[model samples]
Target: MTSQNQTFERLCRTGTSLSVHSTYEIGGEARHLALPHTIEEVSTMLEGATSKGLDPFLFGMGSNTLFPDRPSDDMLFFSLKEHIEFKLLPGRLFVSAGTPMTLLALFGLYTGIPSFDFMFLLPGTLGAGVYMNAKYFSHQISDVLETAYVIDKEHPERGLISVPLSGCEYGYKKSVFMRKPWIVVGADLKLPVDPQLTPEQTDELFAKIKSKNLSTSVLPNYFRHYTNELNAAARAGYELRQELLDVITDRGGKKHFDYPSCGSVFKNNYTIGEPMGKLVDRIGLRGTVRGGAMISDHHGNIIQNRGGATAEDVTDLVKLVQEKVEAEFGFVPEPELVIV
Candidate 1:
């Protein structure tokens, strides 16, 4: 066997539960799953998969993805969630794709920079955020991203290719990354001001954050951990920003972490002049259920796995929402949830 094949075999876990990897807490057992901790490992795995004629399905955090109930045996599922890294540079911050988006908020809090406050409590990792142009109200990942480093999926050996902010072609919940066969590895974020700490201190702070066991995909656990971090920072006299505190209030009020969900299931139709949640509410579809999945009563845009929900259950509800809304509103809402 080739060294890359051996390395990939060592990384692969057989009969892994996809449920634990997704915030939605659905999906059945996957035949092969791998979590690569470095870019080289990722390349090795991809090369090995190519040699085996196995299609690779790449994801990060699984916050917005719906894995199949019966995954194909020929597919190789992999995630970059274990590859978190952060580096402070001259005028920008370099963050690995696996780093949680919410961590950027904590980084900003420590550095006394408010540019990343919008990422507070944002679910998913940096790669997925950049892929989807993740947004919170008016702020989005595109606003802060300066350059994204990616690997062409067709040619992993070609190594990292940099795409500047201007080349990303970002729009509302859209980016050029979405149109290309590329895997985002990391990005350089524009810094609004100099950080409050020295380079060594920054490294120490990131090391501390990385040491914490906060990488679980469970929504409630993820929420409680970050909220506690914010409170701890406030106790340390970091002076919590109102914007950061308000994120807690906003997301908490929406019950975003109360159940297993992939957050908003659909993109809002701009011409409709109303958000997806409001439209769902208007169509009297809030609290609708299919098996164990339910349209969240608190937020109509969300479909939650209340308990023991399967991928089919969630997709059934998604279709129901799409059908009912289209019948009423004369337009079908496009799903934001990525069904794998």
Candidate 2:
């Protein structure tokens, strides 16, 4: 393995700050990381890691993730900042996952394409978008994605291969690549150029939507939600229904607001029970607390990390809610993947 001094030459800490806590900014000490400048370099680094008996965890834009206070020490965190390469072909633009989704939206807006307008405000990476089928403002990344380049997990040296869009098997936020450690080198997106929305018009729409979106999120105590609001709202009555959704939106996107929570501490298990919100509420987990983490008062299914929270705090809170819900209801809310 190369000495630590040598590794510093190829990669460096760019910047670090308090990231907004949400799937967008689930809390942890980032130790802001960067990747080598080229794909071959990245491959070599991966190979080097293999030689050293270490595994690197792939991180893109750090969205849709929660980092425990103590993440795996052996894992070398890398970012795709330099890896993202953008290109324009005829009417379509090709983008890489390291490219911010917002950047893509801005590119489309400036260039007069309306398809990416909804993506303008999403807090995720290009690769993350392809993997998560990122959704917001009424569109999913898959709707605009054309193709992507993925590495062969079995063969690190096999390099990146372009994969067809249909093969991604997008459902909700899950995708084929999401379960695997294969890295995203870049991606191609088919876009339109004619009769495009003016940059000003696109910006106006984006600002309005972003404002509405922020107001709906960034609320105190609310963590990320367990399911989409529309589904829950439909379950509730009409006027009350809108109120339900508005409440969710008012909290920052998901389980990462006003606390150090791994968003949606529990995953919704549709077959085992009724909607998750009602079940947890019945157990009185709504507004319950364990250490610094608390089951949100606004939403029963969420566990908020109040401040100075630890992984143990959140985990214990999750366990308490699960046990309570199971005793009261005939079901257990499965944990969304815990970082630790």
Candidate 3:
């Protein structure tokens, strides 16, 4: 479908707030919200927004992000999240930007390839993940990424553009896409796919995983999730059993997932000798509460929403932690979350 053919009236909504769209459940209302399901729809909305002198921004699942208390009426937010695509080709995965990481993981697991297990537990949509070079433990999506289909915001007339992995310049939580007006529409993942796994073998692996009684604690709602590698390691007696358990388990394993909060308020200082969370813990910031926001008693890095917590409440606690942590260690930590 062409943008010229689809009417803007059909794709846009008015008086929508960020709290309803985001995972953090924060942000004020934008003047317009457009749920564009096609490339043409996206282009059309962008053109219309610009023509009206409105500032438009792309929004994904809203994970790891923060927005203002009251957005201006000129702001327009575009979402392509509902138009998702995922399919297994002979050797690679063809996934749209809106596809969930959890689905990617399950696809890999079912095919006898378990490398993406780390991603299964991650939050946010594929587009956001790719833009941020989303990392889990030691792995980032860049490690397995091959090519991404991008919409060059500067030149939408070029149509859907395909760029190789090198064009992205992905780093730890940074990418060229973040710098430019590039919007990822789709991506190709180059991960191992097992063709030898018979129906019996597939069933056996599925049964084994199911038998573990995997916690149905709802991953997106949680602050952190377990990696599939840990499960595989445990099953294979990977020799680092105790160490892996220690690394993977925090506050009674899955308890961290029970709380509503953006996980890890601070980004790790690459030059720091230890994790920022450790410094937060050593400074006795754990269990500190402000309004409905509380520094998790289980992990120092987390600021959880006890109940009915607003974005301001979380910001207050974040400031408090920064003040105390900096005073104690003489090191200011960077925020991993995107505070708009």
Q: State TM-scores per candidate.
A: 0.98, 0.67, 0.79
Write down the lDDT of every candidate, Cα atoms only.
0.90, 0.58, 0.69
Most lDDT-accurate candidate: 1
Candidate 1 structure lDDT: 0.90
Q: Mind giving the per-residue lDDT tens digits that candidate 3 earns over 1-340? A: 4455347767778888777676556678877788777667777777777667778778666666666677778878877666566555567777778666655665554555655655655656678888888877677889888998888766667788888999889876788887888888889898675456566764575455434332222334333334554456447654333323443453336355666656678878767688877888898888888877788887888887786667888888888878887888787787887776
lDDT of 2: 0.58
Q: Between candidates 1 and 3, which one is better according to TM-score?
A: 1
- Model 3 alpha-carbon miss at residue 263, Å: 1.8
Q: Give RMSD to native, each candidate.
A: 1.1, 8.5, 5.8
lDDT of 2 by residue, 29-100 (tens): 545344665666667667656665555666554444555565444555666644555665655566766666
Candidate number of the best TM-score: 1
Lowest-sum lDDT 10-residue window in model 3: 213-222
In candidate 1, what are the lDDT values of residues 1-340, reduced to their tens digit? 7778789999999999999999998888999899999989988888888888889989888999999999999999999999998888878999999989888888888878898899998989999998888988679998899999998877899999999999999887888988998999899999988677877887798987676538788999999999998888888899799899899999999999999999999998999899999999988989988899999999999999999899999999899988999899999889899999
